[model samples]
Target: MRLSTTQGLGDEPPETNAASSVRKKPDGAKKVNIGEWIDGRYIIEERIGAGGFGTVWKAVESKREEFVAVKEVRHKWLNSPKMLNYFKNEFKVLERLSHESTVCPIDLVRGNGTYLIIMEYLCGGSLSQRLRHSEPLEISTALLITVRMLDVLKACSRLKIIHRDIKPSNILFADKSFEQPKLGDFGLACFKSELLALSPRAIGSEIAGTLTYMSPEQLNGKKLSVKTDIYSLGMTLYKMLTGRLFFDPELLSRAGIKRAILRPFREHPGRYRPDLPYWLDELVMNMISVEPRKRPGDPQAVLDVIERNS
Candidate 1:
């Protein structure tokens, strides 16, 4: 990756470079001008969103004549070695995973110290946006979405990939039709073998996922497995069904969170929407069980239970 010199950005631009091609923001970050070509292929369009890791942009691949989503690692975050590793690891995981419900990366490119990950562009926004814009989802729609996610989980289990972060933002509709949901953002995902390699540090290492959707083990920084994803999935389902988080943010102290998580959860799907089937409530209850052992062993089992009960 060529590092472009834009001053105080730790990179030196070419000695004879023309100023017209690069535009620097006030914050010292270089912004890709709309219509500018990246890596001689993708044309920058508009920035879509940003998160802890980086900014995402909607771009077009001129040669392929297709629209794509490009995620760029922030210049500030690139200073951390761990963050760099995470960025590369996300590329690896995305390259390895491909399923109907999983949004996998198509390419990773670097230019002037900028790392960009190209992904399939989804016209419909994230599940989080959907939830925020509307009332609680209908039970049928929620179930369909959850079932498809479960299928993705089952595929992940077979592939030995554990998505450490499973939340609403990572779940996206493939298009405006909203018929296909694709799970993206794998920066926190790690292979099961990698977790085993890091077992010594797993117990007390810093947590690496969203707290609101974290599994108990994840919040505690314990060795993770597929069950971790299941717990988050349960939380995601709860929000979809209730349009509210199960745990109140006010009760986030160590003891408070532990107590709330450990205690048998009493709220059911029917509590929010009386029309939902009791079976859904039962499935979610089993999934959100505080003990990892208590949750369904895998997404396959969860799907089977759903089918048998429905």
Candidate 2:
């Protein structure tokens, strides 16, 4: 159930408030009992969300009756000695991030063989669901979402963290109580200096994110910077506005995907939504430009441009 912002903030409804107090089964991993309490604090509740790497659960702190989100990294995947180290390293990176719009880790727990991260429990579902099922949101609503997300990216940039993946699915919307959107899932996030200084071995090469939202430089396996994320955000905004992707229909084939990446934005915009404002269209075009350098210098600059147009 999604909470509406119109209900006003700070009042937890009786139903959800009651359920929030009850512990239930956690979502995702099958081999273990996810509802089991970790470190005798967070009591695993029902599964709330999932992603490629792990599942997120609504959990309650038994001692304080406080609610939180628990992200569990699958034990099987983490058992690999190398992967375990990488998982631990990622946690360290997350610890360095502190932002209201970005989901922050509250606690870390290491179980028999798995690792769990405790985070703030957001009542609303993901932005991806809102975009996919709901009617096309008003341009103002879309801009509000974009501005909040940019706030998150700006905070991450201050700490030199580059969120390689920045799509609708990774952004969670809080119910009216929290009111603001929160950016989640930092598993693929990398430090700017570390990414720049990496040797081939250190990079541990692989295509790491969703292909539909990938930046051209990312597709080519080049080292990424903040601009790569800007490109993705631009694509996301385009999809949100038009309710369609910016790719060619023929691009699903092996040869076509490469060709579509090189396709110009002008050839595609008219096909989706011709009525989009010229300035907004131009901003998106600049964002998904084939050259990363051609994209906005930073997420803040993108937000500034949108706000100026607003």
- Compute each candidate's TM-score over C-alphas: 0.83, 0.79
Model 2 lDDT tens row, 112-146: 44566777887787777777763555677767777
> All candidates' lDDT scores?
0.74, 0.66
Candidate 2: lDDT over CA atoms? Answer: 0.66
Using alpha carbons, what is the TM-score of model 2?
0.79
- Against the hidden true structure, what lDDT does model 1 obtain? 0.74
For all candidates, the clash counts are: 4, 0
lDDT at residue 235 of model 2 (Cα atoms): 74
Model 2 regions more than 4 Å off = 1-34, 176-179, 196-207, 248-255, 262-271
RMSD (Cα, Å) for all candidates, in order, is 6.9, 10.2
